[model samples]
Target: MSDTTVTSSSIRNLIKANIRNYSMVLMLALIMIIFSFLTDGVNLNSRNFTNIFMQNSYILLLAVGMVLVIIVGNIDLSVGSVAAFIGAISAMLYNSGANMFVTILLSIILGVLIGAFQGAWIAYAKIPAFIVTLAAQLLFRGLTYIITNVSPISLRDDNFKQIASGMANINVLTINGVYYTALVAGVVVFLIYVVLEIQGRRNKIKYGFKVSPMSFFIIKLLVIGLLIFGLSQRFATYRGIPIVVIVLGVTIIFFSFITNNTVIGRYIYAVGGNARSAKLSGINSELVVFVVQLIMGGLTGLAGVVFTGYMNSALPQAGNNFELDAIAACFIGGASASGGIGTVIGAIVGGLVMAAINNGMSLMNIQAQWQYVVKALVLLLAVFYDIYTRRKTGLG
Candidate 1:
């Protein structure tokens, strides 16, 4: 074969292999560009960019936990209700003169216990996860109403409210209306990413695995680095990085490490990919499911705290449809319907896609109902893509 033909064939194979990894990112970019034009550039405003993270932080958190649950071949319908209940409890505690830290700790503990309770029924008793979580959803929703007396509990503590609404500007420097601290942080992040990528490539080469061409690798780094730097500059032009963004960032990093680097993470994929085979191989599938539930419950509680802070109150109807948003994000981010095929970063990107859609539609003054219709369509298309890919690969 001619050298040109071989080069073209290799490029085709590379694109085919990496399409799934980059498709959602491209889709997100496309949606942002389209919405920016539709909204006369309002969608790309710096303030609006920050609002995207602040407003959807809780949903993103739920998505992180939900993806893990889905990967374990289960679903937790109760997270929204659980978050509501936990938020209500936290508010009551704060009103009753409890310390803010204490209230937060107790709320998270309560959420963990609730998770364990439901997990026992699903994992040990072998009740269907769907049924158990569904019942808990109703049970907790009712409990929230009872505790809050069907009214909103106003939070008078500004410090507690800052958990979601505050900014973390370091006041180190500024250059042409951009915060230097944020710019520096962005540079640091890019550097770390570069290191990791090089190390990963080196390991692949060491293992005799085919690696991307050096030119393609350099292009990838440049593209991603520019994106990171630009995003930081955007945020710096605004009020600086949000407290919630920091929290969300930490959650993403932690969960990504857990899912990508840990032994339990491997077990989760193994169990989800084939429970029978995992069990036959002496893996404790039940324990994995239970532990995952506990983690989900804890994250749901943390999300509750953040949401309550964002609202500045614990409302009786808080967290409505949150589970739906999280589930949709997981699916849109390329998670498999049959489980065992998702990533933490993908879930976050999926969440950002949902946030962008909601934010952009609102900016364009579209009706809320129409927004729902559009979201439904997007979700359907995402699932269709998943099915198509699976069938194409003969995995379905």
Candidate 2:
């Protein structure tokens, strides 16, 4: 009877733990379902579903970076302003008859320059990141107004626009007698995951750490297979996945590797979890912050390119209030404000949730005021759940 009691208690604990971990994802699905019915099933079309990623790619980019910044116990209020500045620069270069290649290179360089400048202020001069980035937000936004004269710069560069507009359908595959591009892409993705898993396990064993549980490994593979297949099917009958989706997927994998596999990543987590202790342990906290910001700036530049290309224009006000969306996405993804906790996967999930909210409400033809109200309420609920879960786990 004691053993039975133990099993029951353990099962209950597992249920609670899972509920806490996956509540946001569950909420996202719930919203999707509610909006699907509300829109008479018009909200989940293959094309419209893919459009969500194209439209919100920049938000995903910014939120990924912001998660790192927030994980390190810092804030960057300047990203929106930086994006606006770079968008103007990109527009100017394209208008000057510069090639798309040159324009992209210049914009990324300028963004890195801005990040280095901010890092110098915060890391070397010892200014608080909040103050430095806040000031930067104002200054860069002001600069954007000056650069573009508050006018919209419509892009006429075909190659540049194609970067955000094109889709990679791969080739069609006969799957159970149905010709499907999703099936093709799904197979490729699953093979890639399998190869990667083997390589990762080999590396772990090479380093002498215990390999992850075989059951866990298989579970991860299954989950990835399902996700890739699901998303591929959703967009299969359309134009396949957008190039922007490819970009977002690469960013997710890249950052996930950074956060999980590198010393810089470890130091980032340490500094965020406890700065003074990390310092005493010989971690260069400031350098970590600087490098992270540098990377953030570069990603912002990339996001700007995609954003402008998708719109076929760059406006001085293109990124208005975008920082809010990015920050909200990060926090909603289970990132702790206190630092040292966040995952690339979580950030993606968070960004998708917000995008779903926007897209679904629009599909339902909800009033603008009600949309805003509903989004605000969802944001509040996500944050509250995060707080409650953390406290319940004694991590708050």
Candidate 3:
């Protein structure tokens, strides 16, 4: 074949190989477009855009941890209960005149201990994670109710509430009712993304690995940059970026680094890919499982705090079905059912997809039951796609 033909063929193969990674992005965009038309553009409004992030912040946090748990070939069915239990404790502490910082710290510590307890059983005792966490789902949920006496504990602390509901007020620059801080942050993020993409491409080339065509690479960067700026503009038109968004962004960055660049990350994939092989390779699979659970517990605690702050109270049903949402996000975001494959970015995107569906349906006045049906279908299809792709790639 001619050089042009060869280049075109390579591009096609590249796209085909990576379609799974970008499919969720396209799906999210398609869903947003359809919802925008159905809601008469209300779904695309700045206010509603901000609301989606605020409403789904806790689930997104849970998904971050859930993806890790799933990546290690384990599942956490008790995150919802753990979150509620921790939120209840935080509320009680605040009510008893504890400082906000202390309340948050103690709540997270309690969560970590809870995780350690469960992790010990699954990792050291070789108990099935599903069964252990299933029992924990019942255990912590009951504890949540008993501690709160089946009543909601109100959070009177405005500062604590602000964790989920507040906005940054960096008045460094504002013009025409727009916050320039958000825009500046957006530009910085876009620049960092561009730099990283270029560096990654260069490194791949250096390592003699095939890279996408330069034109395709540039286009990818452009699209991502547009998205970054577009979201920032939306937040700028509102009340600046929400504090929860900042928190989520930091968490995403921190975990992304750990997963992408750390040794523990490889251990996780190794254990999930083949426990026996990983153990033979001296990977200490049990330790990896234990650490993964510990991290999940910490994130669940943070989610509990955020959810409580958002509601300004610790309701008895504070985190009902939260585990389902987080797990669904992971599956939809491209996590393999058998584990050893997933990304923090994928989890975030998966979460955004879920958030969009719920928000869109609510905007259209759809019933909650139908929303659940749609989510269930979406999740099923996502897993089906994963299986189909794995088989086609000879990995299944």
Best of the candidates, lDDT: 3
Identify the runs in model 2 with alpha carbons over 4 angstroms from their true place: 1-20, 169-182, 194-220
Tens digit of per-residue lDDT, candidate 2, span 67-164 = 99889998889999899899888988888899988988888888888889998898879999999999999999999899888888877656677767
What TM-score fits each model?
A: 0.94, 0.89, 0.96
TM-score, ranked from best to worst: 3, 1, 2
Residue pairs clashing, model 1: none
* Model 1, span 194-257: residue lDDT tens: 8867976896799798998999999989988988888888888887778788788788878886
Candidate 3 lDDT at 61 equals: 96
Q: Better model by lDDT, 1 or 2?
A: 1
Relative to the unseen true structure, what is the C-alpha lDDT of residue 126 in candidate 1, on a scale of 0 to 100?
Answer: 100
What candidate 3 gets wrong by more than 4 Å, as runs, is 2-6, 202-209
Candidate number with greatest TM-score: 3
Model 1 C-alpha RMSD vs. true structure (Å) is: 1.9
Give lDDT tens digits, candidate 3, residues 1-396. 699898888877788778778899889999999999999999998999999999999999999999999998999999999999999888888889998789878888888899999999999999999999999999999998899899999876677888898996663588888888999999987887777677767867897989887888888888888889999999999888898999898899789878865789889989989889999999999999999999999999999999999999999888999999999999999999898888888999999999999999999999999999999999999999999988876779
